[model samples]
Target: MTTSLSAAELANLVTAVPGVRGIEPGIGSTLRAIGSRIRQQDPRQARFGVVVEAGSHRAVIEIGIDGSRPVKEIVRDVQETIIRALSEAGEHDDASETRQDSDSSGVGNRNTPQVTVRVQSLL
Candidate 1:
């Protein structure tokens, strides 16, 4: 089952990751727009940030982080986390349907949102 996550839900998920301070300015609204586009994912997944299409179910995320962590590592972690979240949401949304075995991540499904993380500042 494919599930949808809202901006608040996405934001919460992002914030839960270690080192994330908060979203950069103007980012919250961008996330909200993404969330609106995914209104069908899961109503319950509406507690955090949202996903939007930036050409192809893609979202660009701008974040502020703590300067203590290694920049490369933090970026990697964010990528993995968002991917995992999207995968889980997709699985949930497709829970009732039969699935095919493939190497593609869940986000690769039709119209699945892709996330872009931009570290605006290390505070």
Candidate 2:
């Protein structure tokens, strides 16, 4: 059976990766967090830099790196980690090289979620 990962869970996993400083909070995430707090909801439940677009089966992640390793290497690790996590979640593993840009990496067929990693800053 296939399972879906929440944005918060994905964020947690990304943050745990070595050399990952933290999620780079964007304006949307900040506003969502503030709104959640104002509405008496758990702020932690608010989406951070990781955004999972269910309709498109795409995961967009923005992160701040610790700069201990090469940026490209760190980005690749992040992409691979996310892909592994998604695969473990019962997502299909029809791997394909779908490069969206120089910094982003997307793998898998249409049955799997495409992961896009963006390095927002160096910490």
Candidate 3:
């Protein structure tokens, strides 16, 4: 489930996520990191792998984060990191914290930005 995302973007996501440790930055920062490096022919997880699903406007990339990390924390980190990456990549949703109504679009099919996280492992 490697991706076409950028390395710098992936590293930043992993570094910014709270509770993420021993996150081999050289390997990848987030699911996108696992994806990016694999895209370039990384063989670290040649057999054991990530599985992903996506929609036209969003994606659900899965990874095997170890057990110690709380699911809540992982979810928050993923959301935050995705938002940060999207913002950095210029994918603006124009969601202003002060203008809730005008920013609902940032949440989804309604035009807002949003992310959904799922923990598929602790191995």
C-alpha RMSD for every candidate:
5.2, 7.9, 8.4
User: Which candidate gets the maximum TM-score versus the true structure?
Assistant: 2
lDDT of each: 0.63, 0.71, 0.43
Alpha-carbon runs more than 4 Å astray in model 3: 1-8, 15-55, 91-109
Candidate 2 lDDT by residue in tens digits, 40-88? 9644345768665555666778899999999988888888787778767
Q: What TM-score do all the candidates reach, one by one?
A: 0.64, 0.67, 0.43
Give Cα distance to truth, residue 118, candidate 2, Å. 1.6
After superposing candidate 1, which stretches have Cα over 4 Å from the reference? 1-3, 26-51, 98-113
The prediction achieving the highest lDDT against the true structure is: 2
lDDT of 1 by residue, 20-122 (tens): 8886745564556556547754344332233444335565556789977887777778777777777677768767777675565644566455677888788
Question: After aligning candidate 1 to the native by TM-score, how far in Å is the CA of 101 from where it should be?
Answer: 7.5
Taking the tens digit of each residue's C-alpha lDDT, what string does model 3 give over 1-123? 123343334434654565544233222225554564569744322212221222223434344465567767776777677655654443332332344454345434333234444444555
Worst 10 residues of 1 by lDDT: 46-55
In model 1, state the lDDT of residue 110.
Answer: 60
